[model samples]
Structure formats: C-alpha cells, structure tokens
Target: MTTRELTTDVLIVGAGLGGVAAALAAADRGAQVILTEEYEWIGGQLTSQAVPPDEHPWVEEFGITARYRALRDGIRDVYRRRYPLIDDARRIDALNPGAGWVSKLCSEPRIAVGVLEEMLAPHRSTGRIRFLARRRPVAATAEGDRVTSVTLSSEIGEDDVTVRAGYVLDATETGELLPLAGIEYVTGFESRAETGEPSAPEVAQPANIQALSICFAVEHVDGGHTIAKPADYDFWREYMPSAWQGERMLSWTAPNPRTLELSTREFGPNPGDDALAVDADQSRNAGDSNLWIFRRIAARDLFESGFYQSDICLVNWPSIDYFLAPVLDEPRDVELEHYAAARQLSQSMLYWMQTEAPRPDGGTGFPGLRLRPDIMGSDDGLAQAPYHRESRRIRALTTITENDVSYEIRGDAGATRYDDSVGVGMYRIDLHPSTGGDTYIDVASTPFEIPLGALIPQRVTNLLAANKNIGTTHITNGCYRLHPVEWNIGEAAGHLAALCVAEGTTPHEVHADAARLAAYQAELDATGVERHWPEGRVYAY
Candidate 1:
C-alpha cells in the first residue's frame, strides 16, 4: 500500500547462507549493507531449506573460508554450551550434534539461524548492516547497464521498500533478481553443443530444472503420531519413476545418485548405533545405504542417557524429490501450485513411512514416527523453503563448463586453473532427476576455482551473482551449488562490492586490470579466503 525508500553501499537480496555471508563480508569491510530475505529465517539451505551441508572430505581441516569455519565452529559451540551432550561428545573438538552422515556438522536448522544472527550481531548493532526479513523482491529499476534499485514487497503486508544501492547482489534462491533487473541469465539445461559438456543434453530444455525437495524433521517415539494422509497419497504412492526401475517413489528403494542402481536403503528409527563412530566422508562412503542414519540430526547416544528418546532424523531422502514440475520462471499461481505439490510429496512420503513402508524386520510402518516442527521452525513440520539445487545463472565473462571441472575430462591435468580466481570449492557433478524426465547426471569432478569473472555479469555493471546464480553451466552448477561453495561465492561478491565502493571502481574494471584483481585477491587472502588449492593436493570426485 505505502512505499519506503532506503539506500546502502551494498544491497544483498536473499538472506540465505550466501546472502548472510555477503552482508557480513561487506559490513566487515566498512560498507553499509542492507540484507533482505523472503523467509523469516536467514540461513537458506541450513535453516529455511532444512538441508545439511554437503561438504568435501577436507572440510574439517581446510578448503573453506575463515568466516565459514567460524560458522561451523559456532554451531558446534552451541551444542557444547547449551545442549546436554555426553562426556565424549563434550570433549571432542568436532562434535556433530546431529551426527548426520551427510556432513561433519549436521544440526538443527534453527541452531544455524541463531549462529548466523549472532555472526551478524556486531555489524547490526553498529548500524552497518540492516536485515529486512519477510521481504521478497518484486521489481527492479535498471539504468542502461546497471541495476539502480530493487523494490521489495512485504510478506506480512507492510509497506513496500525500494532499495537503492551502489552495488546489488542476487543471492536469492532461483536467482529471483536476475529477471527483475533485466540481467542476461540462463536457466535449466544447456545443450551439449552449446556448452560442450559431456553430461549436457542434446537439446536445451529450459523448463527441465532439477527436482526441488521439501524437507522435514522426524523422531521415532511411543504412540501413534501418524499424520493425516496427504490428498495426493494415491498418486504419489502408485507413482514409479522410469529411472527408479519400478520402485515406488514413496518407498525406501530408489536409484543411487552415482551408481544409478536400484539400491534398497534400510530404515530403522532409534537404532542405537554408536553416534561417535559416524565418519561422514562422502568421498569414501555415499552413506545413503541407511535412510535413518543417513541424515540423523540428533543421535540420542551423543547426549546424556535418556536425554533424547529417539534420534531426530531429517527426511531429505530421494523419495521426496519433487520433479513433476519446474518451480522457476513460471506464473505466480503455477509456482505456488508446484510448491504445494512438493509439500504434498514430502507429506505423502511421511504418511507412507508411517502406514505402509516396509520395515527391516519384515513388519510394515513405523507409526511412532513423529514430526518435529519445533526443530524446523515451522508450524506444518516441513521446512520453511524448498531445497533448490539449481538457479538461474548469469551469463558472465567466464562461464564454468563441465569441461573445466569434470575429473574424467581433465584427467591428471586437474581442473582448469583460473588466472582471476577468487576462491576454491570441490564437489561432484550431482544433478538430480529433472522435470524433463531426466535421470541423475552424477560425475566425478576435480577441486575447482571460482574466478572473479564468473561473479561479474557480462553486461551488468553494478550487479553481482552471489549464489548458485554465477556463470556456471547447468552441468557445472551441480558441483558449485553446494553450501561451502555458495558461501564462498557470496563472500567474494560482498568483499568485491565493498572494495569497488572504497576504490571508486566497477567490478569489470577491477576484474580486467590484473593489478587491481591481484590486490583484491590479496585482501581475500588476508581474510583467509582460499584462492587456490594446494599444488599437489588434488582430489578427483
């Protein structure tokens, strides 16, 4: 109804992990920042999306930025200080509160929200960083080659806010600001001829985006906590994906991402496995063999005896992946419909588990499975947002293709080294089933570099790709879209924006000039941003 105007040195739209990292980095560098989020919580994948970090093998020791390490440490310290952990867990340096196999540090999403807020507390207190929650970007004003302002409408029916900034960062999931700003961006799959990526399809399928999953938390306990059957239960239960080899979508049996084999995963709630023995090394073990321990967030054995009646396991399994439709670049009503369908799919999966899912001991159903809404910070028990694996990528000066990172393509040469490298990340090319009826396109990849050119759009003068929206092809997006990589991308974008503001320069200018680029990278080095991997320490896949 009403309009409000605000100005900042840096405006980050989307308070996800990347957006939060960007805000902190910009604010720490003495830039006035305005960070906004559509959700009530800030952390994207960690909080709103409710997906644990899928990190590299060396995550505990290296290959991450200093700020990211601090966030991880903060998560662990939260459990050590507040939660009732056992003596061994309390003493261990890297105590996984969730003890989830997906990541080294998997805990409650709300915990990540607290840690992220605390990380931005000092900046917020000093008025350097202003966080606007429950605000979604609706419009943008671009002047020739620059985004002058972005208009955000309030979700809670407050006044519409227009943010004018020296530099704008598109950190939203699905790259929400790209189209609004009239930026040149690509969505869905690129053609094999277009990208020369082996994994790319023969023809470009713009509507064939990766499957989005609506995650939820559940714990097994006494008594029946069976939820009402979802309306689409019959449709989902009877559905068998072609790639799944006749396995029902709601069942525990599904095709493995890497192998594509019909792997039957085991599920048993409160199976008192030694939580301390969980070695979450994905490179060595995919860890999805057991649906229960695969993403167990809170192992009861990790805490004091009887502190937890059952292990809190997050349901982000393959069974719940919603590939029926693409959520991005659709009409508002259509997008909402897809999201509702995704929710139904997740709920249907839960209902199936509670009613008809096959047990390890030849029984059927685990009626004791209870949804934990408090853990996810949602009333309906589902996550605040869907886990989006891909985003609208900006057409940049340097687009990272599968040829650059694929281990099979590069061989002993390692990944393509970047002269304008801003950071480093590593993950396999892990594309899930798409709306185009495509199966998983998983491929081993080498540790890769994030070039400054990837962050800078080809035509946009003041806007930066701060999340999975960088100059990465659909094939390469799989590896670059992980938690640490996204954080690094955002951090680099924020720091670059701050540096540009301080230096009275544009991103293109800094990137084109070798000296300026080197100086900017030096600042990143000083801040503990790993610009390059070790000379000999290269790991494939």
Candidate 2:
C-alpha cells in the first residue's frame, strides 16, 4: 500500500476502444489525457474480449469516422507489412487477415492492438497522453454535479492512484463510473410505457440484460489439445436453455437471432476456402451457418504456403452466451462467480467440440481442435475479459429509442434525423438472449446519427458518456453498442470535453444553443466526422 495522485486535463477511466479513442481525441486537441484500463490490453472488444469487429455493411465506404477508417486501414497495413501474405492477398487493398464473415475487416486482435498503440504513440511521446494498464476504477469523488476525481486500484499490485481531471469520461465496459459517481443512469430493459419502444418489455427489468460470452481462439491441428473437463462441464453439457428449443446449450444447434429457429451450424476446421473471396456483408448474408469461419481470426490460405498450419477461429457463437446472470449491478462475489461460470461454459463448449461434437463425416469429435491461448493473450485460452453487450446507460438530455431507428417503426421514412447530430452509424437492432429468460429481439434498423445531446448527462456537468453508456434506451443500445458506433461516440465525447475546457462552457450550453451547437458541429465536420447519412440512401437490413 502506497497511494499516488496525478492530474490531467482529461481522465478516461477505461482504456477500451472508446477510452483509447477518447484519449487520442483529447490529446490531439492539446489536452493532457490520463487513460486507464482494467485489462493488460487496451482495445476492449477488439483485443481483451477477442471479439472481431461487428460492423455495418458499408463499413469500408463512408459511414464511419475518419479515425475509425484509419484504424481499419492500419490493421490492414500491419498484415501486409508484417505477416507473410500470399502475393495475391498482399495486392488487395482491403485485406482481411482472418477473413471472418462477421465483419469485413475481421483480423487478429493483436493486430488491432498494434494499430491502436501506433495511433497513440505520437501522443504518448509528446507526453500528452498517459496510459495506465491493469487499473480498475474503485471510487469517484463528485462535488455537486461534477466528478472531480476517480480512484483507481491496481489489479497487479497494492498501489492505488487517484486521478483528478478537468473532465471525466465514463468509457468503461460496464459504465463502472456511473454508479461510483452517483450519476443518474438506467440499466437493462426499460418498460414500453416509459421508452415507447415497440420491442421493450411491459415492465422494466433492470436485471434482464444481454448475455455475455467468454470468447477464445482455436485452430484445428494434428494434436490432442483437449483440455481437462471444466469443473462445471457436466452441468453445462446437459444444460438446456429455455429459448434453445430443446437443444442442449453446448450443442451446435441454437436459435437464430432473427428467425428464432433451431439452426445447426456446420463446423469444419481448415476448410481451405478461398480466403480472398470472403464477402462479409450481414445484409447480403448472415454467415454464421458455418461456425468455423464465422469469426475466423487468421486464414492460413491468405499467407505464404506453410506459414501457418491451421486457420485460427475465434469462438463467440450463441452456444457460449452466458445469460444466467448479469455482471453489472451485482455484488463483487456474485459478479466473479458469474464470470467464472461463463468461462466454464465456454470451456465446456470447447471440450464438447473436441470430445463429442458430431462431425460431418460421421465422426464423434475433432480431436485436432487446439485452444490457442497465445493468440488470446491469456493462459487459460479464454479471452482476457467477457464480451459484454449491454452497459449501464446514463439518463441524459436526450434518449435514443426504438422509435428513432427501428425500420418497422420508421418504414421508408428512415431513422430520425437529429439537429444535434455529431456522428453517423448503421447496424441492426440485434439483441442476444437475456437473463430474464427471453430470446432474441432482433429488429431491422435504419442508419442512425449519434446526437450530441445523448453524450450530455442530465445532471453531470463534467462527466460524459463515452461508449455504450450514452443516453440510449435498452432497445436502442442493441444498435449503438457496436464497435464503430462506440468509437464515434468516444471520439465525439473526448473532442467535446476538450472544446468545453477551451471555451469555458458546458455540454448542455453547447447542445441547447443553436449557434454554439452549429459551431461545434462545424469543427467535427472539418475533422472528418460525418454528421448525417446520405439522403435517400438509408438501407435497412
């Protein structure tokens, strides 16, 4: 036990994708930033959670922010420069290293970490950004309507650091600072009567959130890689989810998110499909029917022959979705227990795939399936953290609801156009099975805008919602919680915080005043932030 005190212009209390983006944005604006992360890796879903980017159909084109596009390009560049790519694969400008069907830019999480680190290197060298790894937010000190400082406890040591900043950003995966700062926030499902969302439940269920999955990377090779049976393997092996349509939870048969039909996914490792021919467009094809390539992280065929023995696939399917309990708003012990249980579920799924999964050639299992712990940066083969889909959202100046983006609600009219729009994003309202024992609530949604009002909390003056913690109802979080959208939100929040510090004004003031909001938006436009989607180009899928 030692204590340290530090001060910075901007304090981002989670070095996830959003926090990293926020730190970069703030530092670019000449503000000193202190970014912290609970995990050793910086990128949240991209690295620590080992989930590939779940992007929209037009991701390679104009929908995302300039920085996000740069990050994508950086990932591609790394693969081209570092990896031993085949001549044909190296020639392609948009190179997907993994060729995973879930996203057009599916690649290894380690590559993403490299790109993110490179992006932050200039700022770090200038001493504008200070990144603290293995630090988790423990407490917050708020004076009236503003958070002055946050206390962070080191995960590895007994040392603690209290960071005081001009502006505090809540970018943690679960909105950890929201409760610590006593900010007005909402969790889980909102009642239909409250949000007026067609997909909302009749009564608000704060405990009913999306399932969190513990992802892992694996490659099928000629070896016996079967892990010891997880302690809870027997329970999970025979466990039947209520929404699974009589199929075991550990089996390949699971309900499709959209159709809710029992669909058995085909798993064939190292299928040797043309790596360059992967067209990952969810609108054109939901490519999860093939389990092996659904979230493939490394396609061996794309590299020089014999460079890799097997194509590595990241397992993050519906079969491993842990919906029994939520990690948010629970006691520490309870959260730890559920996280352990989720890991057991994932391990059991892997064990089943190696030990008893029925093969296409009438075999019992694929004994070659090997867990790649090095790929995931974990000793146990599982991801460093769980893939959390939902977060505690702040009650803000404006709340995005299903009525704003749902295709069924808007029809040909398209999503609601916000006057205070700061960024644009597009994704379907895809919700996983919840702890409330409810199945998926998939809905087609039009391309949407991230409003400046959503980033401004109703009462908090200096604290901003940087990631999935923005002012979104439970129904709208399904769309806004994706990778690109979270990045956009964080970039906007960070820039706004810096702007407020420079202009000596608050977020509410800039959002409420038309002239001020316009000026702020002009800056965003100049910096390559798309405030609105193209007219008459709204594609709902």
Candidate 3:
C-alpha cells in the first residue's frame, strides 16, 4: 500500500457533528479544511450510532449555534419536500420530523446524512473543504508541543493517508488521537478529592466509564420474522447485576435517572396515542411510558393511510446498555470481545421482545417483529458503531468540575460564569450505568458556558479538543457531552484556529491578550454563536 500526502490549513480527525461544524467554520473563512470519519456517514451519534439528539427543552427557541439550528431545520425540510406529509403535520412552525419522543427532531439517520451533506455542499463545490469517509487515524507526529501531522488508514483497505495541517483537531469519538499524539489526558471517573464532585467515589476508576449501546431498528409485521436466537441469549437472559435492585436485567425494570428507585416501563406501539402529546422533557415526563413511540423513526400517523406500511422505531433503551468492560485502554482482542458481546446483548433484547415480553392482554411472543437493516446501512440491522458517552479528556488550562454547574452547589445562583465563555448549553448531569458496577448518577445542573480554557490544551499548542473530550471531569461531562454543546465547542475551536492563522499568532496568545480575545469573540458573534443564555431564564422543563 502506498501512502498519499495531503496538506490543509486545518485537519479535523473525526467527521462527526463537531468535526463537520469545525470544518464548515474554518472553510467558511477561506481556510482549506480536510475532515475524515471512521464510518461512512459524517454525523456520528446522529447518524452512524443511531441515537437522536438529546437536547434540552428550549432547543426549539435557542441554546444552539446557527449552523446546528440549520441542520435541524434541514431535517424538517427533507420531510416537507420529499415525504408525503399530512397538511397539519406540514403546517407546524417547529415541526418535529420524526416525533420520536426522544427529542424535538427525531428523524432517520439517512435524513440527517442528507441534510448535513447539503449543509456542506457549498464548501465542497468551492474546493475549500474535503470530506473522507471510512478513514481512521492511526498515528501522529509532533514537534515540541504542537502536532505537525497525522497518518490515517483506510478501514476497508490498506491505503495510508497522511495529513499535514496548520492546526489539528481531535474530534474522534473516543479521543483516539490523544495517546497517539503523546498529549496529556485523563479517562474514566476522577476521585472526589480530584474533582470535588459529591457523586465521585473515594478512589479514581480509570476503567470505569459509561456504557456504550449498539442500537438497532425494527418494524412490526403480520407474519413471523423473529431472528434466530442470539448465541448469548441465555447468558444475558439469566444475568442479574448486584447493583440492579434485584430486577431481571432483561426486564423493563431499571433504575430511574432522577431518582435511583427501580421503575417499570411498558412496551408495544400503544396505538392511538398522539406522538406530539408524548412530552420528552425528562424533567417533566421522562417519555418512557410506551416503548414504540419513544424513539419511533417512522410514525404512520404523520403520513397518508397507505404512504407508510408500518411504524418504525429504534431500540436504544436501557436493556441493551453494554457495561461489561471499557472499550478503550484495553488489548485489541479484549476490546473486540466486548464489542461482540454488546452486539449480542442488543440482539438478545430484540429476541426477548419477540419471545417473552409481556403484553397488555397478557400474551407473549410478537413473532412479527422484523429487523430493519436499511435504516442503519448495516447487514446485521445494528448501528455502524456504538453510541459513545464519554471520551479521553485533555488536562486543560481549566478543567470544569461538577461544582461549577451543579444546582446543589450553586442553587439559584446558576452555573459559575466564565469570563472567557465561548458558548452555552443546558442539561442535567445524566450518567448512565457504568463499567465500574455503579448505577445511574443523575443530578440537576443549571445552564453553563463552554469556557475557552477548556478547549485549549495545557501543553499542546496546536491541538484542540473538539468534542466530548474537552477539559471536563466525569461528573461534569455528564452535562457537557450533549449534542449542542459538542457542536458549539467544535465551532469555537474552528474559529479560533482560523483567527490565529490570520493574525500570525497562537491560541494561547489570543486567550491572553484582551484585545485579541475580544476580536475573536466578535467574530464568533457575527457567526451566530450564542456566548450566553438569556439572563435569569431558569431552565425549566
């Protein structure tokens, strides 16, 4: 295999939401940008991982950048222009395309891919941006404290591509570039002594991180389409974790996020229920009463009587959360085993539904449950990759701890305001089950700002964290790892890179000099990046 060399003003090492936003921002300023993704799709969690946006209640009004809002609007436009929608459904001002009860916009993965491609079409045509799919970063070269270049390999073949850029962004899902670049970082949960988070344990658990899920989509059929029982069905069916309040692992009973009390959920389409009536605000309704509409991608009600054959829904519930082992910081073979097990667990959840799930009429076995492989572009009917909740974080100039945003710490005072704020986000500190044998650790948090210090590496001058891998501790990452926040962070990093290049300076100097920092902020304001939330508007569901 031959190695090809490429050069760009900025190179983004993960074409997820963050990478896409970063590339667009830099390329919009006339910077040559090269963005690569490990999967065929550009939107990471929104597309490849099969998880919809986990947004706050006010997403429809504000709390996201303009580019991000455009993506949302574009998804709705796809349905409006392409699909045969009812007049009432099409007339709503803030249309929820999928209306899956998980988020305001819960459309299919393919829809997101289309909208994102359209968003970046201008840059692609102008030759300012290049997007390479199915590419993964393998190695990096550094000079002093700056990353000079990175080597990427084809996931499907042996060809290697090397990219040399003026600035590099680590937007990979697991922060894979951190160790390869020899950058200082941290993973898993920090100790209470380190972060001063009330929920933190006494000792640090490097291997203890949130569980990742391999979600799948399915639709109901008239006849039986039950898949062959998964190989590990028996193992998962019989499994019961010690921390699970004595409920069967495969059952609907799981720990409630707001309160650790065990709660039971009901399954099935629950036909006749209005999709719009399903309030998704967890602070108000949790939205888990019925399984069918929870993440339904194809709601039959929105279309004409025969426009859609069956209602399609995505299965990303707690039953399939894989906490067996940490995927990163482990041997290659061990990691593969865990991934295989996670897939099996997801399949087993489907099998359980088809064979033993309880029904409203006290019946079992919905043999008509058919897996939808077309939705995910995978042969196995599962997502292209697992939904990642955490990433290797840089030990940044300023690390955001739980105390910064926790309502318990700040009360009505709200989140601690940062002088160098770059963007704003709001969400509860919602952590799922972990590989450390711990249950959910959910806490209330106020709206917070994405500090510029968090994006700048403490030692690395040219590398910037563009995703969940910012300077956020485990407790704080719970709130900072949402969709809008990650996009804001990447957009800020992209603009910072462009400004530094134009001024012949570094990010460190831009943050230090008041005049330079104000100029950068002005640039961000002109681009529609909201640096703060509305004054005194408490984030209520």
Best model number under lDDT: 1
For candidate 1, the lDDT comes to 0.92
What's the residue-level lDDT of 271 in candidate 1? 81
TM-score of 2: 0.99
Query: Which regions of candidate 3 deviate over 4 angstroms?
Result: none
**Candidate 3 lDDT, tens digit per residue, 212-320?**
9999988886888889999999999988875577777898788777777888887775365675554566667778767788888887778777776778889988899
lDDT to native, each model: 0.92, 0.91, 0.87
Using lDDT as the yardstick, the better of models 1 and 2 is 1
Which ranges of candidate 2 are over 4 A from the true structure? Answer: 538-540
Q: Write the per-residue lDDT of candidate 2 for residues 105-193, one digit (tens) a residue.
A: 88888889989999999999989999888999988998999898999999999599999999999999999999999999999999999
List pairs with backbone clashes in candidate 1.
98-297
> Per-residue CA lDDT of candidate 1, range 470-537, in tens?
99998999999999999999999999999999999999999999899999999999999998888877
By summed lDDT, which 10 consecutive residues of candidate 1 come out lowest?
532-541
Question: Which is the winner by TM-score between candidate 1 and candidate 3?
Answer: 1
